[model samples]
Target: MINSNDYKIGRIMVGASDDDVRYVHEADNLPYYHIGSVNGISMVTIDVIGHEITHALVKKTAGLIYQYESGALNESIADIMGTMLERYMLPNNWNWTLGEDAVTIRDMRTPEIYSQPSRFEGPGWESPGNCPFPFLGNDYCWVHTNSGVMNKWFHLVSTGGTFNGQNVNAIGPHAAQQIVYWALANYLQSQSTYSDARWSTMAAARDIYGECSNEHRAVIAAWNAVNVISPVCPGSGGRIAAEQIENSAESIMKVYPNPATDFVTIQLFDPITTVDLQLYDMTGKVIKAWNTKESTITFATKGLVPGIYTLKAQTPKGIYTHKVIINQ
Candidate 1:
């Protein structure tokens, strides 16, 4: 019997101090898993056990709503924890793929092979009601399909990779597992979105690894590759004269993907001979400065941490100041 104090589920304790919260016994023709065992001993593999147990933990903690993004999160958490458990149990032989014994259902390292979108590209994805795969067309909102995005996130955070032009430093699997667990138990709400998961995971990483640490930055990069735009970290506030700069700028200037990553485009109504663009952090630190003559400029957001930044554009016509949000 696992003691309640042996492990944690968010801020709450788990299992009973005197009783076993989980039971595994022999049964006949069970439906693989739904908090219970099956008839065949082959059905009780290590990966299967790990996956189901993680689900139990999730139920005890967040009781994650089993639909849409939240449902996908629940599933992704289970898969991630399960895979980690498999690695723990068989470190020499375990693989990053889910399922086992001639039945590999998903591969976390590269979900695109199975027609899953590892990157959550907002509205560019199919409608929530439509399944990208025809066989599971009836499944509401393609919860399983969407699980790939978070799965890939976990994979990249654990193994390290160059994704979407960002170099994610490897945090390794154990730290990755612990950070994910912390996020799931503490940061994620019942109906969290992909963006919410990004924020929650980053917050968890920041708490465990420190804000300036490489782990925190890697978490941000991993989510960014998956197109989960995160809000700025705390302390990005209290800028003097921030409003005055905005009021002086022309209204015709536009920046897209308001909460932006990769790059943000600056568009102008009138062509200018020379335009100077300067990006400032909350503390009035100039992060990126550009000088150009084009009416439209695409500014790269690489290496900038998540936060609200001030963009001051100086043109022959007028001085334009705009607020741009760079999400992880």
Candidate 2:
């Protein structure tokens, strides 16, 4: 059995180059890898523990597999969990990249690494870079490779990382990871891929977090920012978390422009770790979500039709709820 101490959070093996992510013998084991040599980077191996562990958690909790959209989502869950876990251990600024934080592997937040799309560019999966498997029959053999899109998206969405000109006061990674953990462990169905996985995740986010919690918005925005197949959110949606809920046991969640016209901003109490923000309509439906793993989050309402909306956020310990409105 592989000693737990032998493995790291983002990367499993030090010399094992077969794959970046390895299932180190431990309670938390899954796909994905980390490559680096810095103390900060080496510490990321421990972060790998959470990423792989999330895989097991989802496998047992959601009964997801390593194939199709479900496979992609499974990979995404691992990546999200892995990065969040690593971030949890180390401070920001010093920790970045999924592969070679210690040795310069890949950036977790920036999807377009070195001017390359995180996902493979064509239907033909055969690549020239480090991705080992050849995309067969349009088969997504690039599960781990393509997952970079969601990985960077997760990092961005979780922490209010910017894409174009959006500002997000995201919740934090701790909450976001826990939410995904619950989602993979409980809500998600099988045969889920990128789109399907996201849809299930939205529903799960709604259930655990709320209808239009920042977590929900974070999910929608995260997918939107990535330009994935538009996640089918119900037309009529509602609110999940409140920036400042009154007369309730809800946690302290905050976002600006409750009824936003141009942009919606998000904020938290402490130094944020990771959080996903989601938006919704009136009829208990999903609109879009964002993953803000940083300290804040911002989303644009320019395209929105203009109506009542809600934002949802997923934190490390539990779910946070908030409300927002778009004036367009």
* TM-scores for all predictions: 0.57, 0.51
Measured on C-alpha atoms, candidate 1 has an lDDT of 0.67
Per-residue accuracy of model 1 over 171-225 as CA lDDT, tens digit each:
9988888778766765577888887787667755654555546777778778877
What are the per-residue Cα lDDT tens digits for candidate 2 across 1-328? 2336765433344544333444433345433333324433353364555656677556555666565445556766776766666666676643545544444445666645533244334232224344444354333554555666667556655687655443334757765665565455434667655665555556555545665667776776666666553333345253323222211113445677665779987766544566666665553446787766565667777777776555656666655545466777
Steric clash count of candidate 1: 3
Worst 10 residues of 1 by lDDT: 12-21
> Candidate 2's C-alpha lDDT?
0.55
Question: Which is the leading candidate under lDDT?
Answer: 1
